[model samples]
Each structure stands twice: as structure tokens, then as C-alpha cells.
Target: MTSGSGVWITLEGGDGSGKTTQSDLLADWLTEAGRTVVRTREPGGSEVGQLIRDIVLHHRGDIAPRAEALLYAADRAHHVATVVRPALARGEVVLQDRYLDSSVAYQGAGRVLDGDEIRNLSLWAAEGALPDLTVLLDLDPESARVRLDAADKPFDRLEAEKTEFHARVRDSYLALAEAEPERFLVLDASASPEAIAAQIRDRVATLVG
Candidate 1:
């Protein structure tokens, strides 16, 4: 809203791809370099968003694909209205852990919804908003599953899906990056945390130059 003053940077990846960890590191580096930074995550960056997030992430029963996608979109609209847009208006760099890309990957590709449908939903939900730069953390499906297993937590319904679903999500992400090369940075996530963090730093330096 404040005329090219703030940046929206979104981090995208499969579960266990270290998006949470890397997002934090990137925020810290940005703050250290004297940028006003806001760190937040999807499905729950606002009060309403959090409520919707719980329904989407932890619901014990089966939710239809379209139903699930709408819930996610609702959460994202709330998040953008309350959290993301405000920070950007104040000239703060918004470092989001996930954004519309998740919807396209999980709901569109993974759930067998048409990609165009998801894209339209994204545009509607986001009100034409998008990240200035999206960093996709690429990792093999097996490696990601191993990392998720190491997390030692009960897997959610979505997380508990077959490996094929996750593979589709990964492929969708790759396609997204290929389609929007100028706005996306694909990083190899199957690396040491520190190394991944370093990769993020170098990218920020180039993009924010």
C-alpha cells in the first residue's frame, strides 16, 4: 500500500523441508542488516486465520478437497488483511513461511483439483497480492518423509497421505518456479541447516540490492 516501500518474501517447501527454521534465520539476518522485518506463517497469522488453521490442520474427520481449499483461502485472506498488508504498508519486510503456493501445490496438484481453479482461487483470496520473491526449498520426497518422521509428532491427515501425493506437490512447486523465474528462487533444501541459511542470505543480498 505504501508505494514500493516494503517487500513480501514467502518461503515454500514440503513438510520437513526446514521452511520454519530457514524463515527465522532469514528474518534474523534481515533484522541484523537493519531492515524492518515481520515474521509470520500461513493458516494462522491472524486470530481468524488461526481459527481456520486449526480446522484445516487438525480436524480429525475427512474434509472434502474443495472444502479444505476454501478454508485455506479464507485463512490467507484474513492473514493478508490483518498481518501481511499492514506490515508492508509500514515499510517492513514480510517474511512469510508459506502463502498461496501451498494451496496450488497441496490442493491443486496433490488433491487433483485443476491448477487453473486453484490459481483463480488464489487471486480471489489474495486480492491480486503476491510475494515479491518466493523461495522454494527443494527436497526429495523420501528425504522429506524421513525428516518428518524424525520430528516425532503425530502426522496430520494431510501429512499422513501417500507419498505419491507429496510427490505431486513437489512437482507443482517446481512448475511454479519455472513459470515465474523472476519471482522465485529454488534452493536445495537437502543440505545442512547452516548451509541453507547461507544460501538464503546470498539471495536476499542480490534481490534486495
Candidate 2:
């Protein structure tokens, strides 16, 4: 259960882990349950964040790992202040896709940077805000690749990285969940979307009840 009046739930996973689909399902279910749901995503939730998202995800060039980490932190700082905090202040359930965890997993572990530094930077940027519940959709790199390929869409900067990079990201996510079991609900991403969503709903119900 959330300590605050508003419940903040984050959905985290590697690329093609079905986070977007599951987020949609959870949002719809919460809405049907008569909750005020504010569904959003990092690096694109606010107008300022959209520009940062493009630079970090779609830009064609070599970005220094540290620069990339800072860019994400910039987006996160603005996003939480303008979007997430306000929603939570209004007592609305904020269902977010990705958050500081993504930065820790991608930039820290995948990019081989200092994980603690990356996490500290993100936490400082977000003013120490942390999600009440983090639902991690765990999947293998190969299965994630298959799902990404099935989408028939071009890969983004992170998605285009080598298999080893994604594997590292997954390892980091699992490690984070293990370190914070009470705050995390780690689910198998290979499961059907309905099943995944059902499990998420059950956990969220406890928070919003």
C-alpha cells in the first residue's frame, strides 16, 4: 500500500517487454474501477521531455555515456516536477512507464557506468521521489529481441545495442527488484498479456484499495 494519498506505480522492463501494452490495460482497468488514473511515460511525458526523448533515443550520433545519463536525468527532473508530482498531489493514481530504474538499468549497467552514481543522480533530480510500486516485467534478451522484431519497427538507440547490453540491463533490473522486494513486483514477461495485467491489477488493487 502507498504511504501517500496518491499511488504511484511504475512499469519497468527492457525493450519489447510489453510494458506499453500492460500499462494500457492497467490504466483502463483502474479507470473502470473508478480511480483517477494519470498514465504517462518518461522522456516524453512533458513537452520539454519530448525533445530530450528524441535526442536520447532517436538522434543519430555518438553520445557520451555520461552525457546520455545527464540528458535522461534532465528529463526525469522536469517530468516528475511538472507531471508526476502534480498528479499525485491531486490524489490521482499515476501509472508510469519507466522511471529512474530505467536510467539505472540502461545507462548504469548497460553502458557500464557507475550504477550508484546514476541512481543517485536520478534520485537527486527527481527530488527523492520514488514510485510506491514498481512492476517489473522480466524477460530474456532473446525473447525480447523476438518481440521487438515482431513489431516490424525500427530499433531505437537502446534497442539497437548488442545482446550483451540488454542482458546487462535485465540483470540490473532483477538485482534492483531483489534489493527492494517489498516495493517491486517482478513478473515473467513471457506470460500472456492478460495474465501479466491480471497480476499487476491485483498488486495495484492493494495499493489503491
Candidate with top TM-score is 2
Give the alpha carbon lDDT tens digit for every residue of 37-72 in model 1: 988888888888888888988999989999999998
| Residue-by-residue lDDT tens digits, candidate 2, 1-209 | 22448989999999999999999999899899899999889989999999999999999999999999999999999999999988888889999999999999999999999999999999999989999999999999999999999999999999999999999999999999999999999999999999998899899889899
Backbone clash pairs for candidate 1 read none
Q: What TM-score would every model get versus the actual structure?
A: 0.96, 0.97
Instruction: Report how far residue 177 has shifted in candidate 2, in Å.
Output: 0.4
TM-score of model 2 vs. true structure? 0.97
Question: Distance from true position, residue 1, model 1, in Å?
Answer: 6.7
